[model samples]
Target: MSSDLFDRIAAIGVIPVIAIENAAQAVSLADALLEGGLPLAEITFRTTAAAEVMATLRDKRPELLVGAGTILDSASLDAAKASGALFGLAPGYDAEIVAEAGRIGLPFAPGIMTPSELGAALKQGARLCKFFPAGTAGGPAALAGISTPFAHLGCRFIPTGGVTEANLPDWLAVKDVLAVGGTWIATTSDIANGRWAEIAAKTRAAVARVREARGG
Candidate 1:
């Protein structure tokens, strides 16, 4: 199930990390992404409004693939599940969180920055991991270098943080990177300012970039 979820994510090639401060904006935001031909969204737990917004999107916009990010503990994981999130993303790897998620059969991707962390996650039965703070972790070049040893392990990555339109091609060009997560597509300020059209436009352009890079 986890592999299948990652496959779907890879097919889309991008996941918008969004934080909707207003639950009311959830449906329209999802509509905008659908309008742009992208239907995946990762709503982060950085705000008090995250759980409700996630539930709103899940219940109302059933076609939108909504996942929860910034999940740090079992509590957040439970909340994410209770709110109907399909998956959970953490800023870093945690053994207990991985165990609990597996116990409950939740699809999860823990953040990995170093080879040691990757090894640990693999030991915990994780096949896909998030290369978080991707830019600070040395961008695509760094991910390529780190992925060499793990290539045989079939470990794939979804690099988040500081991923933008300008550098997306470089990230996607790395064979091991299945997809990327970026907030630049629908930033907090953009949502606050009600810039749905701009967000949709950026989503469309990002999707075009992915297709061009993959020769699709």
Candidate 2:
């Protein structure tokens, strides 16, 4: 994969981590996000409908930058790849999954909670890591602290979990955070209520917040 892909992901600021209960809602959710000017979506493997949703989005809206999230094993990784995900993300690092992603030429961001895990990830050749359970893992402050030590290693982070609109600016302000991830903007309840417009509005608001934080 081109390094530019990482730049593209970072430019979006916040990646909408989505879990689809109904396969039919995939395209609509993707459309709402794209319309709001954010092109990236991390369709998580939290539900069985994830693969179907990935296939549907790939077939219907190929322009959206879609990836699989919450992948735990190689089987889930392969299923994501087969469904057309361009990348894969896990809540925690797994050597087998990371190796498979590399073999398939798919960019993967494995999770790291501590400096030790981060060090091990770098040893394994991962420059980009996910700070999962961001709130429980110390949020942006913890990330800020870790960044100082790991800065020389050229490590970057994508903060996920417990990320909210109110706290997004704090997370984005941290220089090491390349992007943030959250599911609040595209929850199943929003889709169930057919609130696409509302979701779009939330997406736009979130993007604006990121831009403001980035001084864009």
How do all models score by TM-score? 0.97, 0.96
Note the Cα lDDT for every prediction shown: 0.89, 0.88
User: Which residue pairs in model 2 clash with each other?
Assistant: none
Query: How well is each residue in 14-46 modelled by candidate 1, as lDDT tens digits?
Result: 999988898888887888899998999999999
Q: Considering every candidate listed, which one attains the maximal TM-score?
A: 1
Over 4 Å off, model 2: none
Task: In angstroms, give how far residue 71 of model 1 lies from its true place.
Answer: 0.5
Q: Which residue pairs overlap in candidate 1's backbone?
A: none
lDDT, model 2, position 165: 87
Q: Candidate 2 at residue 93, lDDT?
A: 84
**Poorest lDDT segment (10 consecutive residues) of candidate 1:** 1-10
Writing each residue's lDDT as its tens digit, candidate 2 over 47-160 gives 999999999989999999899999998888989999999888899988887788889887888998988888888888888888998999988889888768879888888899
User: What's the residue-level lDDT of 138 in candidate 2?
Assistant: 89
